[model samples]
Target: MPTVRVTRYVTPLREGGSLPGVVEAEDLGTYVCKFRGAGQGPRVLVAEVIVAGLARLLEIPTPDQVVLDVDPEIARYEADEEVQDLLNASAGLNLGIDFLPGAFGYDPISEPARDLAGRVLWLDALTANVDRSWRNPNLLVWRGVLYAIDHGASLYFHHSWPGGTGDPVRFAAQPYDASEHILRGYAAEARDQDVVLGKRLDDDALRSVLAEVCDDWLEPVPGAEDADALRERYVAFLRARLDGDRGWLPGEGAA
Candidate 1:
């Protein structure tokens, strides 16, 4: 991923608790930057990058990610005190996704193609993402293409890491309840895609994906001696879940 210096702080996204802002970078491109200082913390950004990597392997159309280097001096020019505070606090590397101008929020009034829906559902299930319900789909329609975003809420086990890296096997055994998934109608498609999807993320591919994350982004854990150890724990968790039995996998629903 490319790193860009923030040239301007545009606006706060009024919705999410993380207060991700629209910012202009030195590359003359606009991006939605997730602040490192957000209450949910850097772990969410780690999840975002890793999941985006997985989506890339699956051919999912997600926004290109970049690391935004924020400058504290820019905060003084901000009018909104809240956004100013966020900028002041996030004066270093933050998460940025290419801003899709005029993208509309996804509403599940109709179904998308089965294969695409299946790939999406499978990705969510594999990551244990619980956020993509109808109310907050976290999906966008840009230039008539569907794009996935905001994966910070996935990988629930990592929140326990301040104490220790939790058991990967327990996460592997955890069952996904897709009854309320935005793409629940295409559960069968997710299952069909699952046969080949897990194989796509072999050890090497997983390492490359984890490498996208910078060492500093990983929060320190009790037993984790360094960033490589922290990354290994994530890889171990993914391997366990991917190779585990399909018992937790969702069943078919109406097409």
Candidate 2:
């Protein structure tokens, strides 16, 4: 992944609990950065990168993600004590989601084509992402293209790693309820692409996407000694989900 140095803290996006903020990078690009020091911690950042990588492989439109090298020194200029604490906590690498200028939040009134919407629904189900609800769509529209964002909520299993990274069999067999999904209206269309889409997640493709993830982001956890083991765990969980069961598929894999 490309690394960008944060030159300035633009503004805080207080809408979310993680307190994400817009900032300018050395590359002259702007990004909404997810702080590694946020209450949610670096796991959410890892989830963001892994899920977005999969989205790109699945041909789903999403913001470009990069690694932001943040310096705590910038926090000194901020007036808000709360914001200052957050900046000071997130001292090193953080996740930077490309800021889409003029992008509008998604609404049912401007739904995408059935196939595109269904594809998104399908991807969310596969990842067990529960964040794409109508209450917080996390979907954006720019230039008429629907883009998925804020994937930190996608992989929830990692939070349980304090006990040790358990076997992925359960995650693979897990079922996803799409009743509250923002694109639930297109669930049926998503079913049609299930088989074809599953085929695209071959080992090679999965590895390619995983390669984009930075080693620093893969914090070691029980059952995974090193970053390579951590990557394998992610790969194993995904491959198992694709091959283990279709329980997570929307409509129970009906096409």
Candidate 3:
């Protein structure tokens, strides 16, 4: 990911639990910055990087991500106590998604293409993402294009890790519920996409995607030992899910 120094904190986006912010960077670009020190911690950033890479590989539209270098001094000038506190704690590298000006939240009125929706559903199911329901689509519509965002809620298995990674086979066996998914109706189509997209996630492709994750974000876990080990765990988990039974695919005996 490209690195950029945050020059200004534009405003706080309080719609979500973590309270990500819109800010300006050294490259004269605006971004929605996800703080590493947020309540969910760097693990959420790890999900963001990994999923974003997967999205790109599957031809999903998403904003460009950057490694935002935040200065501690910016916190001192923040007027809001809550915002200031967050800035103070996030005085280092944070995750930044290039902000799209005038983007509107996605609604059912303007549905995306069937193939696009299927690919999205496939990606979410593959990652065991539990956050793309109708209640919180986590999608943005900019210039009539649908863009996926806020994947911090996916890959729930990582949250259970005390010092090591979770069981890949267990995650692979877990069934995904598409009843409330934004693209729930496209489950059948997604299954077709599953066959095609699944084949694309070979070792080299997964490695390229995993390479985008920052080492700092891969916090050391007990059995994992270090960031590289942790990354390998993630790769293994994903590969297991891909190569394991396709029962997790929506409409394929999935809930």
Candidate 4:
């Protein structure tokens, strides 16, 4: 990912728990920056990079991401006490998503095409993402194109960490509850998309996707000795999900 220095502290986007913000970077570009110091920590950032890469591979539309270098000094000029504390805490590298001006929240009333919706559902299932419900769809309609966003909630296994990393097979066997998914009706198409997209997510492809994640965010847990180990763990988990008996695919037998 390209690195950009944050030039100015902009307003806070108070939509979610993490409290991501809109900011201006040295490249004269505006971004929605997700801070490392947020409640979810760097793990969420790691999920964002991995999922974004997978989205691109699946031909899903998404905003560009960059590594934002935040300076501690920028916090001094902040007027809001809450925003000031957040900026001060996030004094290092953060994840910056290219701001999509005027993009509106997704309206399920006018759903996406079957194939596109299928692909989105497939991607979410493959990653064990549980956030894309009707209550809070992490999708945006930008200029008539559906774009996936806020993927930090995907890959839930990582939250369990050291203990969870030990069993990739278990995660592979895990079933995704797509009944609540926004695009649940497109299950048949999702199954078809799985057959196609699944083949593309081979070992090499999975490695390439994992490569986009920053080393710092791949912090070693108790089970994983180093960043490389952690990367391998992620790859193994994904590959298992793709190659194993995919009961996780939402449909007739889906949970």
Candidate 5:
């Protein structure tokens, strides 16, 4: 919603064995820049910008984030070649995310899996993030609720946009059926003021939020394929969920 400027480029942090640069944002506070090497890899910053911003609009619990212009001259950390190679080989070339010093870390939820169903459904339906599984523990439990992080791996099926028409992913538009676990979990947290959870998305809100956050980035990166195909796929996915039939609470929402 507000213009973000990258300022005070901080040293990089090694997470998942890659060097991700951290920068202080004059308006948004802090951000982690996933470095892009010469080789090919999914653009983590673009994913963050689209997914995190959209997640916020969908009322999902995501860490506040923004895209940052990186300064190679100011880069204070040297990446370990072996680690970089490994991440490059396994996770591809982009550097991992740079988080802030006070960013809170928490244990995963310990209750029945049902509590996380709504979250999983939201991640699947909207961001289409593939990382937040029970095994990966990408969802962090702080205080008493869940917060989502590490979305560097989603929308990978379509890497680049194709001249703006966009890729069509049928799953994007399908209604994400709430599992019994999701229904119970959302109901349990319905009264919890501190918890930021995803209620089912309606079509208009879903499209509006996606356009607001990702429309600009839908263009292809230089030297990369047009990103419009991917953008279309993402939009279609959101549309399917909104238009499809799904059970949702009356007024639960997040930002």
Candidate 6:
């Protein structure tokens, strides 16, 4: 992977969305970063970086995300009052990710749906991702290839955590289907091989990948007081997930 220096923090693209920073990439592409010291905490941006890095390790088609330093003076939220309000409510959210420019759609319930669903199921089990749904599949269809995106809502279990209060929304139960459907026109051999579908996502491999990529991003920022502790917490949480008793792997899902 090539390193891209986030030398400047241009004006944030304050469109209506979850993350705050709308930045200009360095000859790469436009990115929507979670600015550091933004609303909530550095944890949000850090989590995004960690998730994307780990997903790549799991062989998932995830967009590249990285930290970019910007002089606070150059940073300005968009002019829209509602956007600013959203920004104000959530400040210090700059961390950029290249937004792929293209058009794609999911062919669910069709032949290709099985492969797509399998990849998605593996993604959910690995990261414990909970956002994919009938409304927000989060999987994209860019040029006919399935690409995963928007994982900020996963690790934290922002909706329900530390307690089994409600049902786990496995993104429309894509992980539990029996027939294993795929793209209608795909060859039988290809479908039988299940190559487009991923495995359980080796837990040890996942941890190693996370530990490697997150080292730089884990460094404490100048402003955030709890940055170090937060980073450590995230790493430890990931370590536990990779080696814990979650019983989320493949056939282990039935256990």
- lDDT per model vs. reference: 0.89, 0.88, 0.89, 0.89, 0.47, 0.49
Best by lDDT: 4
TM-score of 3: 0.97
**Between the candidate structures 2 and 6, which one is better when assessed by lDDT?**
2
Between candidates 3 and 6, the one scoring higher on lDDT is 3
User: Residue 147 of candidate 3: its Cα lDDT?
Assistant: 92
- For model 4, the run of ten residues with the poorest summed lDDT: 246-255
- Poorest stretch of ten by lDDT in candidate 2: 246-255
Give me the runs in candidate 5 sitting further than 4 Å from their true place: 1-3, 36-43, 76-104, 112-117, 141-145, 160-169, 172-200, 212-216, 221-233, 241-255
Give lDDT: candidate 6, residue 29.
58
Candidate 6: global Cα-lDDT?
0.49
**Per-residue lDDT over 35-131 for candidate 2, one digit per residue giving the tens place of the 0 to 100 score:** 9999679889988988898888778899998899999999999998888999999998998999999999998887598888888998898888989
Candidate 1 residues 148-227, lDDT tens each?
99999888888999999978999999998888888878788788878798889999999999999978799779878689
lDDT of 6 by residue, 1-255 (tens): 333444343455443245465556565556766654455455455556666776675456777765554444333434555445544444332466766677454546534444444555554554556566545566677766677776665565322322322223332222322122222123232234333332333445545545533344444433323445434444545544544443443342221
Q: For model 4, how many clashes?
A: 0
Cα miss at 245, model 2 (Å)? 2.5
Tens digit of per-residue lDDT, candidate 3, span 1-255: 899999999999999999899999999999999999897899999999999999998999999999999997998888899999899888889999999999999997776898998888899988988898889999899998999998888888899887567679998888888888888888877987787898888988988888888888888777797887888888888999999988788994333
Clashing pairs in 1: none
> Candidate 6 regions off by >4 Å?
1-21, 37-39, 75-77, 81-93, 105-116, 157-208, 211-236, 244-246, 249-255
Task: Name the candidate, 1 or 6, with the larger TM-score value.
Answer: 1
Q: In lDDT terms, how accurate is model 4?
A: 0.89
Better of 3 and 4 by lDDT: 4
lDDT value, residue 180 of candidate 1? 84
Runs with alpha carbons beyond 4 Å of true place in candidate 3: 252-255
Off by over 4 Å in 1: 253-255
Over all chains combined, what TM-score does candidate 2 have? 0.96
TM-score of 6: 0.59
